[model samples]
Target: MPEPLGDDLVLLFAALASTTQAEITAALADAGYGDLRPSDGYLVQHLQHGPVSIGDLAGKLGITAQGVSKTVIEMERKGYVSRTPAPEDQRTRLVDLTEKGWAAIYATRRARAHVNRELRAALGSGASAFLDQVRHLAENSGALAALSERRLRP
Candidate 1:
């Protein structure tokens, strides 16, 4: 029979996945938005700062331009973002956040902060510090940083 996964590995993976999902769901709820997932927020954040092309947003999210275009269309329909003709290139359109998008992003940030605070409190000072150290170590790895940067640009 195959060996079971190690305790540390299981805990780490479960914690990472659950925390990400919980944080995302909480943020969306706090923003008074529904039907928007973390992937939506990821795209919204990039467009929130300013206008960007579909290709650029795709590159930032490490997805294909076609995929980004589809998501952008959905978001546009939801009134979170708008696509307008780029001044420099008539063929390409740039995506920009609407007021609703800005509000959502702001609320997400605030909700995430609250979640982090609650986590810290639950973990206690020492455990929280240790957990942060672990997170930093995991995040600071060269390959991980590269992957994250590729996925999250803005």
Candidate 2:
């Protein structure tokens, strides 16, 4: 069998991913976000792009419609989102971000910047640059393209 990557490398990558997310979440909380989680951020970011049906959000998030509904309900309770009947389809409701959601998203963006600074300090310029380049490469790879296709397909 081909040699596997070193355990240290695998652990490093895992730690990096976890730390990045934790730092961003902490940053969002610091900026006045309540009931914040990575999933919540995903919902806000997608809704920020445009209104979406619960089914679409569930598909994008790789979650069940029931799970998405639960998350949406929590967000609604926290005033981060609101549901409005879709004009095109009265049977469907579109989830839209409220002012609170916008604020939460903005705070999360700022927090991510702070986390990026920490990453720069920890990884140094060279490793950081390499990570960025590799991320772009992976994002453009066939695997990612296939995943994206799956997401867009009905």
Candidate 3:
């Protein structure tokens, strides 16, 4: 039988994920976006290209339609996003980022870059290899595909 996955490996993955979020959170806070949660940043990033329907957002985020709706509501309250009737389909509402939302997105990008720089400095020579391994795992992992399949199911 193949060797079982080590608990340390799992913990390392979890720590990496949380640390990245924490770094982003700190960056946002420094940029006067302490009020925006990680989820809010994600939504803004998705809307950066243009407006999209709630269903489309749900699909892209691999989240439930209800979950996307709730996030949109919170974003609207914060003036980060706005909803308007789609001209092509009045029944559908399109969500777009506001000027504040664009600012948030820009800040997020800058914060992410800063975090990356910090990580590289901390990791020194090992940073590139570590990043490559992480990227490889993320791209080859079946977990995301399975999650998407489950979410798409009725």
Candidate 4:
């Protein structure tokens, strides 16, 4: 028997995610969007497709509705997100990303791409297989549903 990855996959992925997050943070700061946090990008991923209710977001994020509301308030203050009354129901409020939020999204994408390219270049052909295997595992484990459903979580 042989181990191909040499160590635990969880640690590897965590390190990679952290590095990419740092790059994203620095990139956003460089682009004049210092108010955004790396975690903020993940939190608002539901808004990428369209608006979502705070209750729905709470359920999706595994947090309380009150927590979601507080987060939305902070994000709105930071200019990354906005809350509006749902037209269909006056009692419901919907959350969506603002123009500034979109810029952070782009920055995150660019930073992740840069890291991917760097790893690909360093790993040569093995990088593709490694990535493919990771994706395959993610899909089989139901983890990829978040990506397909336009959801992002920790």
Candidate 5:
């Protein structure tokens, strides 16, 4: 059997990712984004690329249309997203990230970088190899493919 340290890599990865997320969330709150829910970050990240129809967002998120609409509505009210009538279908509306939403995305990226800095500081010269190995393992195990298909769930 492997050593105890290698026995629960999944749990270790999860705990570390959760802690990093908490740090990012706290930074967002301090940046005046306390109104965002835990799951809202997933939606915000998904919308970063461009506008998408409600149905498309639902499909990408694996949720119902109404659920996506409710999320979009709340985010719209908070200035994170705006909906407009789609050019092709006036009956369908497209949700686009607002300037505020983009700012949140940038802020989150900076927060993650800060977390990485901490990792580097803690792990020193081993940090790069450590991260590369983690990714290598995830890819080999097919976790990356699954995650890319559905995205992360906060």
Candidate 6:
């Protein structure tokens, strides 16, 4: 017999996130915007706020600037994003969502809502409690700051 999986919070969260991502991907694929990946989704979410420099995006996403640049290059090629000289600093490029990028963002939002409804239905009365726990974890865990610090270290 196979060993039972250990109760690890990181693993639990990763598994849940992966499942949710797969659902979102499938829904987007069905909607004709399947070219987007999970990384692209993150980029789109960040761009939704406003244009940001690649370095800032890298910091926000806890990734290397090179990695963000690579993803941005691909997105730019696909017309999902546009890079322009930063008004305050010509040397820095600010990335913004193109029209297609906005469409992708809207599609992702709709798909996410659908998945949330499905999860709520499946989880029943416990769904709200689970969401509250997740919200608390995200807001107070300092995990993002830790990740950013770790990524910034040599």
For all candidates in order, the CA lDDT equals 0.78, 0.78, 0.81, 0.82, 0.85, 0.84
The residue-by-residue lDDT of candidate 4 on 16-128, one tens digit each, is 87887777678778878878776675577778889999999988887899988988999999898899999999899999998988877887788778877887998897988
Clash count for candidate 1 is 0
- Which model scores highest in TM-score? 5
Question: Which ranges of candidate 1 are over 4 A from the true structure?
Answer: 1-6, 143-154
lDDT per residue, candidate 5, 19-81, as tens digits?
Answer: 988998898888888887779876776776788999998888888999999999999999999
Residue 40 displacement in candidate 3 (angstroms): 2.1
Residue runs of model 2 more than 4 Å from their true location after superposition: 1-6, 127-129, 140-154
lDDT of 4 at 57: 90
**lDDT tens digits, residue span 1-154, model 3:** 6445565677767788799989899888888888898766556656767999999989877788899999899889988899999999999999998998889888988988888898899999999999888767756886556443433221
Better of 2 and 3 by lDDT: 3
Give one digit per residue, the lDDT tens place, for model 1 in 54-126.
Answer: 9998888888999999999998998889999999889999999988888777777777778767767878868
Q: TM-score, each model? A: 0.80, 0.77, 0.78, 0.83, 0.88, 0.76
User: Candidate 2 lDDT, tens digit per residue, 39-60?
Assistant: 5766665686778999988888
lDDT of 6 by residue, 1-154 (tens): 6445566778878898899999999999998888888767666767877899999988878789999999999999989999999999999999999999999888889999999899899999899898888777865887656544433221
Could you tell me which residue pairs clash in candidate 6? none
Q: How many residue pairs clash in each candidate?
A: 0, 0, 0, 0, 0, 0
Angstrom error at residue 105, model 4: 1.3
Identify the leading candidate in terms of lDDT.
5
Q: Candidate 1 clashing pairs?
A: none
Query: Candidate 4, residue 54: CA error in Å?
Result: 1.1
